[model samples]
Target: MFVLNTFDIGECLSFLCFISVSLIFCFFMLFASSVLGGKSLSRYKHTPFESGIDPVGDTSLHFSIKFYLVAMFFVIFDVESLYLYVWSVSIIETAWKGFIEAFIFILFLLLSLFYLIRIKALNWVHK
Candidate 1:
């Protein structure tokens, strides 16, 4: 049913040429860097560098559970905001049904937030 025209063929060939050229350039750069870059490794080069700060006593540190809980709550709310944006964009098409659903979603989020607060999930000093 469909046929490729001369212009389409030209465009496809141009795309292929561009892709091939890009791949060749990337390969050449990688090869050149591996052969020429980073000569003579030293002990100082291998050491961990933190903003020119010397290596500290301990690298491992314990994080508070409240920090993780707050992070998770932030992520959950951020993702819900994305969904709300999508729903808002399609609000006209979805009409009344979309409005009610979005309202219910917001209500649930609020309830969950209240529950978390009531359970002291966000409290840092209490723990």
Candidate 2:
């Protein structure tokens, strides 16, 4: 039961046109590359090359648990920062209630960080 107005229809048409043009450009570039790019069947072409030197040993490296823990912490904090940014931007609309909610959110983040520190979860080396 939703109806779109003339302005909405115009916007939809423009969006469709933009998508069509983008797809056409992408396909054209792909086709041109396949046609114009060099085709090599040389033995060294498939080998992994790094810093102008031939790659030796396994390319895959095993990472420590600390690396993953730090990465997870970074991602968690990054997402929390995004939420805080949005809340800060819409402060006027949110007013006092939003301020309280954001305060609580920040408090929880600090508590969690402290908990991680107490548990030695953020420590780089195992004892």
Candidate 3:
């Protein structure tokens, strides 16, 4: 088997294609395994439990939209911090370009902050 150096454009594309194919194949295999296993589909699985007590009625209750919004805000905050760590490492090497890229990244993230402010999402004052 003759190996091609990554400097060649063909080799680089092949490398990317290999990664894409491997990821897609792995995902499909995992999905197929879960679907074919089919181990937990019994009627008892649909029941809810409270302290090992019998299930209660009206389990399909609606929740406040604010609850979901708060969860999203928390996820955004955590993911944005991950980006900051990568930016810190890159800025030491690339200087101005890295700084500009990091600034742009924060600018986009600030849009979420702006939205939170507009909705008074963080306000604890009773309406």
Candidate 4:
């Protein structure tokens, strides 16, 4: 025999209610849009509008490699900082093992940074 406890039944009912409400809301919005929306055939309406300023020049402009390199460095350092923050927060619980691991991680990051600097990867003027 299949049996469900009060908690299980309540959870199931809650889930079903949530799903039904979401569906109803979605359908209502779709129906309302269809009823109230206006059709437009203006030529300017289809063009991309940028704060009323007419777009000029080539859309596909070439960017310097320095820009991409700096962006990549920023992302890498940002993620490293996030890892360091998490490790710092749980330092007391993790103790020496965490400290050693964090040290190694930071060491590798420092080495990579030094290597990039030595190779002039961050030099914008040289390019």
Candidate 5:
């Protein structure tokens, strides 16, 4: 003989609640921005320079390719690690499927990384 309580016995700080709250916040921000900002779109709305000031520059700035490569690599690996964190959380419930899925995902990620290395995408030393 068991009696169920009115309060939730299973809800333990749901991550879905956080997601929903953040979405609501985003919607409010969008609505507020649109309402308060007003519709002031005109021809000169986004002109970078003012007063016809001639842009004084050599216009020949070349960025180091290494800088961009590092940034992109960081982003790729960072996203992969983020997914890893999420996968870890549900690994217990999902069991074998979760293990196989995460394993294959990591395997593919490593393959891509290996491919990048083989292509020398990270090699930035200028000869």
Candidate 6:
């Protein structure tokens, strides 16, 4: 049988204790809310409010594809920035090879951006 070291056993106990405390707290909150919360149902409270503006027009308006393209570009660049951040954090360990790799990565990003600009993918108003 594999025996856990004291530190490992302590960690396990602490984790279990944390889980138990969380469960107890969650159960207590649920019970208290059920017993003490009000049950008021008003028409004004039921209607959805948007920045204090009442529902005015049709909710299902068609969105421009450019909006979706912008969102996708934002996500792609955001993830690339994350990779750059991690690479920057470990720059010293990665040295010249990492520098070359990051340069290539950035080159690709710039090329993609230029392509998008050339295709007018970033343009809000279509010609």
Index of the highest-TM-score prediction: 2
lDDT score, candidate 4: 0.92
Whole-model Cα lDDT of every candidate shown, in order: 0.91, 0.93, 0.84, 0.92, 0.85, 0.92
* Superposed Cα deviation of residue 94, candidate 5 (Å): 1.1
- Steric clash count of candidate 5: 0
When summed lDDT is taken over every stretch of 10 residues in candidate 5, the lowest stretch is 1-10
Estimate, for each residue in 2-93, the C-alpha lDDT of model 4 and write its tens digit: 56543677888999999999999999999999999997888898777889999887778899988999999999989999999999999999
Candidate 6 lDDT (Cα, whole model)? 0.92
**TM-score: which is higher, 1 or 5?**
1
lDDT by residue for model 6 (10-89), tens? 87899999999999999999999999998888889787799998999887889888889889999999999999999999
User: Lowest summed lDDT over 10 consecutive residues: which window, candidate 3?
Assistant: 1-10
Candidate 1: C-alpha RMSD after superposition: 5.9
The candidates, ranked best first by TM-score, are: 2, 4, 1, 6, 3, 5
Q: How high is the lDDT of residue 59 in model 3?
A: 70
Off by over 4 Å in 6: 1-9, 12-35, 50-55, 59-61, 125-127
Residue 102 miss distance in model 5 (angstroms): 0.3
Native-referenced Cα lDDT, model 2: 0.93
Instruction: List the RMSD of every prediction in angstroms.
Output: 5.9, 3.8, 6.4, 6.3, 8.0, 5.4
lDDT string, candidate 5, 1-127, tens digits: 3567655634645766878999999999999998898677788667557478755767579998788889989998998988999989988887999999999999999999999989888887646
lDDT tens digits, residue span 12-110, model 2: 899999999999999999999999999989989888778898777888999898989999999998999999999999999899999999999999999
| Every model's TM-score | 0.64, 0.77, 0.54, 0.68, 0.52, 0.61
Q: Stretches of candidate 1 above 4 Å error?
A: 1-36, 51-53
* lDDT: worst 10-residue window of model 1: 1-10
Could you tally the backbone clashes for each prediction? 0, 0, 0, 0, 0, 0
Candidate 2 pairs with clashing backbones = none
User: What ranges in model 2 sit over 4 Å off?
Assistant: 1-7
